[model samples]
Target: MLDINNILIFFSIYMNKTCKKLISCYNIFFTEQGVRHEFR
Candidate 1:
């Protein structure tokens, strides 16, 4: 079985990567919305 500390470290790294991805996606989405709003 995996050690508890190892599992926690792995989970934190995974979450950090996913959080970066989510932030990037949100930035792109908001930029698109802003452009659309300016055109209207």
Candidate 2:
């Protein structure tokens, strides 16, 4: 059986990568225009 700790670690890593990708996307959007408030 899979270990619960390992599963949690994997999920956290995935979330971290997703967050980084989102930040990069936000930077790109910012350079295109400063109207990021619409995204919020």
Candidate 3:
């Protein structure tokens, strides 16, 4: 049986890691777009 507390902890950790990665990716994508706009 899975413990509810353990599941919550694991989910939180997973979400934190994914959130950081997503934020970095979003930043990179926006930066690229901004640079392209400036060049045009």
Candidate 4:
């Protein structure tokens, strides 16, 4: 049904946004660790 398709599209878009956020956060975590090591 058209309604089901719409839901899938919305879900995919939200998931894409969330995925990007998670990846950016993960990178930041590693960067923070590297910076901490340098300071130590």
Winning model by lDDT: 4
Give a tens-digit lDDT track for model 3, residues 1-40: 4699899999999999999999999999999999999999
Every model: Cα RMSD to truth: 2.1, 6.0, 2.1, 1.0
Of candidates 4 and 3, the better by lDDT:
4
Task: Give the per-residue lDDT of model 4 (tens digit) for 1-40.
Answer: 9999999999999999999999999999999999999999
- Lowest lDDT 10-residue stretch of candidate 4: 25-34
Cand. 1 TM to true fold: 0.81
Winner on lDDT (2 vs 4): 4
TM-score of each: 0.81, 0.72, 0.79, 0.81
Q: lDDT values of the candidates?
A: 0.98, 0.88, 0.97, 1.00
Candidate 2 backbone collisions, by pair: none
Identify the runs in model 4 with alpha carbons over 4 angstroms from their true place.
none
Rank candidates by lDDT, best first.
4, 1, 3, 2
Q: In candidate 3, what residue range of length 10 has the lowest lDDT sum?
A: 1-10
**Candidate 1: clashing residue pairs, number:** 0
Ranked by lDDT, the better of candidates 2 and 3 is: 3
lDDT of candidate 3 at residue 25, scale 0 to 100? 100
CA deviation > 4 Å runs, candidate 2: 34-40
> Against the correct fold, how does model 4 do in TM-score?
0.81
